[model samples]
Target: MALFWFLHLYLSQFKWITALLQKHSEIRMRGIDLPDDLIVEVLSLLPVKSLLQLKCVNKSWNSLISDPKFVKLHLQLSTPNRNLALVQYDRPDCRVLTFPLNHLLHNPSTTIPTHQFICKDNIQFQVIGSCHGLICLLRKSYTSDHTNIHFRFWNPATRVISKELGSFQQSNYHAHDRHRYIFGYDNFTGSYKVVLMCSGKVKIFNIGDNIWTEISSFPRFDHDVSLGSDRVNNGVYLNGTVNWIAFQDDLSCSTYSWMQRDTTLEQYMIILLDLGTETYKQLQPPRGDGVNLVVPRFEPTIAVLMDCLCFSHYVKRTHFIIWKMTKFGFEQSWTQFLKISFQNLQVDNNFSDWNQYQTFMFPLCLSENGETLILASSLPGLCQVILYNLRRNRVERTKDLGRIWSFAKDYVESLASIR
Candidate 1:
């Protein structure tokens, strides 16, 4: 099935090339020659790997492939070829792995080859997230100030990386600070931006700008109260907004008190930060029938599934429920999408010591036809990538991608340059 789609798209591009060639004979009599615009239209349909080799054909083609407009065009056309981006750590070394989704879906039993980007730096960095083929890496400064953070944007497909952008300092840092950051694209400004949320204060850093602008602080909340993958406060980037599932609290409730696990007065809400407006908004999360919306011990995660915001949380540590927001910014559009039992997911069923070894399942990506969903079942130090069939409601296959440092994201290859 994957091969058919690739052949279909490949043949479709050749059809355009054939038609253009046929028209060249007729247009030869006219004064106008075959324009480069038509050539660019066909070239954009090819894969990035092919485009890189084609650059050696002529200087004109090399210049055309490097243009910003061509980069955007290629990105728009390469949406169908999504890959899984995984960051695995082996002791002190880190590796960024990219596996083509089509290959994995087609050959479930085979060990799919992955493209790896080895980080040789002495300092370890974490993948904040990916946007427009750019992976944002975060590293803490080695200096004495514990509040300082540095960022670097790298295009794994293009193999181009920008210089260390910042050693920006947070207003105040604590040992318990989650210090989460999200990378997003601002459609209004046609640029990329990174937003950092820590200590109830919010800051925005534009990609090209060498400065950080402090925005409205997040509603007073505990740093440990945010629900996300691997217990990290990761924001779901979708449609120019970064969304997180957080518990809202009053100033009277201190962060230290949160360690006591007292949640009778706390409330969970979805916080949205608009990259364009640089402001914050709160929305209520999904509420299901006979479902308790509060879970103080377990963490609920927010992810983008089929371009819709999805909320997933474990019920009594026995069942996992996923809710999808069909319409953005509309609380009424929330719908319960999936409810799978722990037995079905093959998760450990040790109920006596469940809290200590609880597993969190996150929906990483959905198939093109939407019949299958890839999930990351994260344990204490291990992560398993599972292929689940939604139509059949069963786990089709599960592969251990080794001990991953963070959850995987959908990666698309592009000619995006961070410089």
Candidate 2:
């Protein structure tokens, strides 16, 4: 009878332990349920790689990560706050400098230093554009043979890179080939497109389709003279159309005049290529005196300010002028909206005396709020990036990268992981 009692006690204890373990397991599985938005916020704060892997956590998470809305939200949250880094890449040596946007907005009283990175050769740095939480980079062969312009789409946040589209050599496309320009798209149906200008032809590559096509002909420029190397600046993406600044010059003149007098001597026109229609139309700037104003290119042409098409012109030894499109008809009037003066810049050095000839060929990016302009200037041993805040009327030097092409590996790795 005693043995039977002991056996019963042992069995009861075993059963209790088993039951406790089962209950604990159940609690762990459902541990502390969180609100959906809070969970998304927390997940967004995590590195993209971690977030991607967490997609397997459950069906809900998998769906969230794949949703376009979530992708945009996560990108906005991941965007660095009040800071823009100016990176210089020069193959083996690289440098990065960070500047505060707040200073550019309120104080304008700081000079940020640059940072460095080591990278390989043969990596060409091309800034496609920045959208949402990502910037697109196009990597091409560093050589000047005009032969192999292989393109890759990269997302810096995820460090993911897309497969190379194709070789320029194989496609009969050359970067220097006149009359040809190249453009890229993340999605053909998407809004973003990169326009590449070559010698005689302009090639438009839709990011959506990842295919290259030629712009058979451009609106005839009266003069036989060639287009400027700064064509990238002239192309603006707006309302599902890519607008290019076209100059009709006096082909008869020995020396083609650009900003010489700005009179109507050379007709300056704007051409809009609707991505949807795949057709081109011409528009004129309002009351534009083609003089002293450097034929602006690569400046932000499309903005929400005043609900019109805007173009920014940075004149030599003068303030930055903003021209707004009043009417979309054949007689479009470009009214001067804002003029940012040198005194308003509040720089230690006079901006007018600063060599305006030393301009870098990168696009000016606006902040999320659409109130600031990001400018990058590169000199022999020093490279500087500044933010000019329109609303606050201040300018701050945010980054001072010493060398160009210095952030190659970081850029490459950042792009590679995104894929």
Candidate 3:
């Protein structure tokens, strides 16, 4: 991979030479044309900015670059160039600030530069999920009677956004009847989809079709083990499915009586919905030998690290451990990725409340080299980003990021179109 990227950079340096060659009479007279495969190979390595500019060079080149196959190829090669899309909602208009991952990784002390996208009409928006280059968002507009909610898709690289697609009324207005939205791609159908989990029911919206269809509801744990709160955010999307970390309480009368004498025995598992099949499946967390895994006072969060589903949780209220799934849907595939102590992160464990001391730490993004991780450590009203060095097992840098709703997402620039 290093050698391939070195060659890509080497070829990119000669872009001016290619333009100069086109001006030469000898090359013009020969009318030499590169083969389609060769053209795609070179173009796919260039950044999205350069490809967008080159599209105007000629009609054939424009068509080749716009082809769906080429788009997929470019996206595959663009993974290493991922960006950090940080969404700040405190402003009247929500702003998505895009920062190059390389810049943040290389210049830890410098003031990083960013590209900003301001929301229109000063409407408030909350990020649902980011996949490919498209960001799914929930827009809330105030009306005289109530708030109107809509779903919108935005591609910051192409600067093309879809109009508000659909509005859903709450199936139940109870206090605990909260809804969560997740965005992902359907590899089988070659479409982008949005999954909505509302009041225990599931619904899907296909971007190309601009239609929402009801799907199977989340599986209910055997009646006694009631499902717990679903305050999940930015679910991990991989292999045509979106996964969330959910818990079930052992609410049986006998279990409740036992809990009074014993301890809380809430079982946490991964709840994933396959986009192709529109069905739900559950996978238990890793139970390594000699390790008793249980849901922390707060909960563990899941993310995609190194293209694998990872689980991050607090251990003994002292260490933060992350586990990665080597194979999707395989319980035994879970491997410990890293373990960092609170002392290493400089976390204060002096809070009066035990739950406050067990702060929620979320893994936001991981560096391409896999040596550093961007984490969001959240307290009641405070949230901050920590850049941790995996090799040294220490914190590299800390930034407040002002105020953010949640952790930043690992974003990529692509030409994936949305309808």
Model 1: weakest 10-residue lDDT segment is: 258-267
Order of quality (TM-score):
3, 1, 2
Question: Ranking by lDDT, best first?
Answer: 1, 3, 2
Instruction: Evaluate all candidate structures by whole-model CA lDDT and list the values in order.
Output: 0.69, 0.47, 0.68
Number of the predicted model whose lDDT against the real structure is largest:
1
List TM-scores for all candidates, in order: 0.84, 0.62, 0.85
Error of 2 at 65 (Å): 0.8
> Considering only N, C-alpha and C atoms within 3 Å, which residue pairs clash in candidate 1?
none
> Candidate 3 versus the native: TM-score?
0.85
Per-residue lDDT value at 193 in model 2:
52
Q: Which ten residues in a row have the lowest lDDT in candidate 2?
A: 407-416
TM-score for candidate 2, please give it.
Answer: 0.62
lDDT by residue (tens digit), candidate 1, 1-419? 34334434655665533443445445666866656766676678777777787677567789999999999998887545687766766556556666778877776665645435545455566778888888887765455545557887877666788888867665443546667678899988988888776766777888767678887445665434543233244777889998876666543344446434434212567888888987777877777774555554555678888899988776666787889999997878889999888788777645444343333567787898999888876665336667788888777554565546244677678888776
Displacement of residue 83 (Cα, Å) in model 2 is 7.5
